[model samples]
Target: MISMIMVLNQKGDIMISRQYRDDVGRAAADSFRLQVVAAKETGTEAPVKRIENCSFLYTRHLNMYFVALTRSNVNPALVFEYLFQLIRILKAYLGEDFDENAMRNNMTLIYELMDETMDFGYPQNCAVDVLRLYINLGNVRPQDEPEPSQLTSQITGAIDWRREGIRHKKNEVYIDVLESVNLLLSSNGNVLRNEVTGQVQMNTKLTGMPECKFGLNDKLVIDKEKEDRKPGVEIDDCTFHRCVRLGKFDADRTITFIPPDGEFELMRYRVTDNINLPFRIIPAVQEEQGMTKVSINLKVIANFSDQLYATHVVLKVPVPKNTAKAKIKHSFGRAKYEPEQQAIVWRVKRFAGKAECHINAEVDLMPTVRPKPWSRPPINVEFQVPMFTASGVHVRFLRVYDKSGYHTNRWVRYITKAGNYQIRI
Candidate 1:
């Protein structure tokens, strides 16, 4: 349970503060500003900080901090989640920079939001659409509001993310699977650790309470069905949105959920097995008599869709602090030395599928009196492929149904991007 919610700016001024229960006093607020904000407490440590008898769980968004204070033992995860939701709601109303000005101008609406979202230290309906239906800049008159009974039922209903009687003539659902691959390679091009983080985002424009079921070519389901089949991609862990029925998913490995309106992240998952890497970086560095010789090569192979091309490929190669000059030769794109970063930045406008690219740079550095090993940092690469998933995760099916049984259109796309794709030398 929460006792107080406060928003503090960078200079420690309280932008918006609300107390849900008397268990927290105004003195605690002053103390938080002094002890936490004034002290410039770093967030690398635990998020939950205890000052006197109160526990504070806070997160920063934009130039402000959203803090929740509680005296009792409350769920830390729930507190953080609620704080994020509150930020989302504020951003929805205030556009960009939902900061002091936005909150100050809409103080009444903020108070209404705080009261409605949390009552007696428990989270209520915090959905943006639900809150916007009634709470706005001006007061919502009784005549302008929906039926109290129906609104109340929607708030406390099973599917709170969606609203009632939503309509879309197109009745279309588009699912996009995006995966990012993170890699750490040794100097000899041997993989140390590799991981793929993926997210499934959906843009739903269906009407009349459509029930949806999503299917993935998951290893667990495949193994249970066919024991002799070759093992496919395995998901290490996954987390779904609140709309998904966890109990139903646990009973049977079925992803059944009532999707939220508009755009939302349906699910996020991690994969570590059978990752089809799209880029391989190879590096060779040597120390000459009076200068350093650096030779680097990057190979971006399009592993899927030979005709499709990857766009916006960038590779960053770090250099020594006292680097004198660099000569770069590349087959495609632009490569130049970035003096501010002490690194060579290379960019490829478009890398074709089933194609390879290479870069070689020779650097002449001023000799130093004290010889030391160049603490070479890992090379970072970033690229995006339109129709490919690094883990080869495929959506087998997406079935949607409603009481009205209206015809619906569905579309699916896959994308793969680099996430800390690094190589060390």
Candidate 2:
């Protein structure tokens, strides 16, 4: 439970403060500025800080800080989640660039929104859509206002995300499975770290309160089936949208939810086991002639099917800081020495699958007084491939049910990209 909410500027001065409960005094707000924000400036990751009987949970957006003070032992996740929700709600009402100036102008409306979202010390309806129905910056017409009974139902309803009577002529559901592969490779061709983070994004245009049941080729379900006992993609951890019935999913490995209108992320998952690496980078760096010159060779091989190709592949190969010039050559991409970055920037517009590309560079070092050894930085890579999943995860089925029993169209697309991918030279 939140006792007080405070919005502070970059200098830790209070901009907008609201007190929900009298348990925590106004001095608690000062504690956050002194202890939390001050410590944060000195490279401290204090998202939650306890001071004098009050606990402060805060998040920073631009130059403002949203903080919550609580006296009781509250769920930290819920507090942080509510803080994020408050930020989104304010952005929805105020424009995206809502800064100190905007906050000053709409102080009254912001306070009203704070009162509506949190009652006493508990979080209530924080749906932006529902709040916009009654609360408005401009004058709301009598005809535009919803009935009292309808408004009450909406605020107290189980479906907090969606409104009633949504229609579509051609019902369609678009699912996009996007996975980002992060890899850290050692100099001796060893994968130090390999991880794939993925998300299921859905764009729903179906009418009525349609229930969606999504299925993935998960190892848990495969083991439960007990047929063939073949292994599936192992998900380390996953989080679903609030609309999903978590209790049902816990009982059975079945994902079921009543999706909101338009586009929303259905779920996010992380995978570490058996990651299908798309690219294999082999690097050889040699210091020639007593560190006066350096020779670098790199081989990039694609490991996917030959049918699909990757686009906009960029590889940053680090060079010495005090380098005179670089003579670089590549087979499949354009390579140029970037002085500011101190690296060879290579760009390949189209990289065919099951293909190999090579790069050779001879770097001449500039004579320096101290002659300090160069610290070789890791090579960073970035690319995107359509119709591919680095985690080898596939959607088995997507079942939708509604009272109208209308026919719906569904489309599924897959994309794999590089994220934090690096190779030590």
Candidate 3:
């Protein structure tokens, strides 16, 4: 009889024979039975029978195979490193017989493993190492050398192009790979190569387009000319189009006329619905100056066309100034003038058994003195006088005024000596 022993070690459990006994022995008999069944079913080689058994060598070989297969299921990083190192070792020892498939697989595996690991947290050194490995595996040719299209090179270029878009700092690398791809595709006469190149060139040209505009819009052109146009009236000259006045008393109303050129005119006058009146003009004689005084003569009509209260009429006249005293004689009364103040005050009385109206006014003269002199020290004097009306009415004229009364009042007189009085007894 023979014995079979089962052993459990660090690698795994195995069954062993203690001796190679006769075919009739139980251990040998069981082995032969399993071989007979396998040969009968599949018609293949039967199990081998060892004449001498070595447990240590068998156990060693079994553990080595088991460990190799187990490591295949481990993390790819370790697998990649192992395979990479194996390629290097094989290249060093086995020389040209080094497995190209194994090297390529390991290089690709390293790249995939690095990408996966860095998905959660980037590892710069690992990524660089993977790139270096790929470059080495692709066997990058020198600039002068013409090499055949390699699978590894094509895959590496694609990987680097994608990485360039992600990491813009590697833009040169992306461009280089793209150029290589173009060169390859162009060599193969690919249609897509021409299309992509044309598009890139077109985009580059568009980016360099001119930034400035040349012509103006219509509104802007019109506004530019309009800005330079001048206003209708000159600034320094006096201008008048029409005149109108409203007041309570007819005698209180006075118009002072300072002739612009030596004379002026009241060209047109109209009276509307406010009064049933006809407009007229009157001239009075000045005894001292021998000048004719101009005034308005207005008379009330018994029946008029429009309403009696509201009136609107146009009076066209040249521009007038207040300098010389004048009077407005009305049917109702008369008003007095203050020459220095450029104003009028009306006076009323009964004349020819009816109420008559009159006005006295002072007019302003055009400024003869330059505006700068008024700020200096000045001497002032005041006086008064009384004059009688034609109806024996007592009236007073006061001249408590300045010599430089207005800009138009020139230096006509100056006091030379101070008057003093002395009495001797």
The best candidate by lDDT is: 2
lDDT of 1 at 291: 50
- For model 3, how many clashes? 18
Better of 1 and 2 by lDDT: 2
lDDT of 3 by residue, 1-425 (tens): 11222222222322222222222232433333343322342224321233224111111221111011110123435433433443333343335453334333454543443343222221222322223333443456544322334434523452321121111111110000010001111112222211111000000011111111111112223344566343211112112211212221123322221111111121112111111111111212122221222232223221211222111211111112323545444344434454543334332222221222232232333343432221211111111111111111110111112132321211111111111101010
lDDT of 2 by residue, 214-324 (tens): 999898887787763456888999999889999999999899999988888899999999998999999999997667899999999999999999999999999988888
Question: Model 1: clashing residue pairs?
Answer: none
Give TM per candidate: 0.92, 0.89, 0.12
**Error of model 1, residue 326, in angstroms:** 0.2
Give the range where candidate 3 is weakest over 10 consecutive residues by summed lDDT: 172-181
- Which is the leading candidate under TM-score? 1
In angstroms, give how far residue 10 of model 1 lies from its true place. 1.8
Off by over 4 Å in 2: 23-45, 49-54, 136-138, 141-146, 223-231
lDDT tens string, model 1, 1-425? 99999988878777788988988876786787787777777476677789998999998887787899999988899999899989888888887566677778888888888899998889888878778667766654655356778778877777767877788878999999999999999988788989999999999998988889998888887767684364557899999988899998887788998888899899999999888888766676766665566555555455656778888988889988778889998888999999998899998888887776677788877778886777888888889998888898889889998998988898999999999888886
For model 1, where is the 10-residue window of minimal lDDT? 291-300
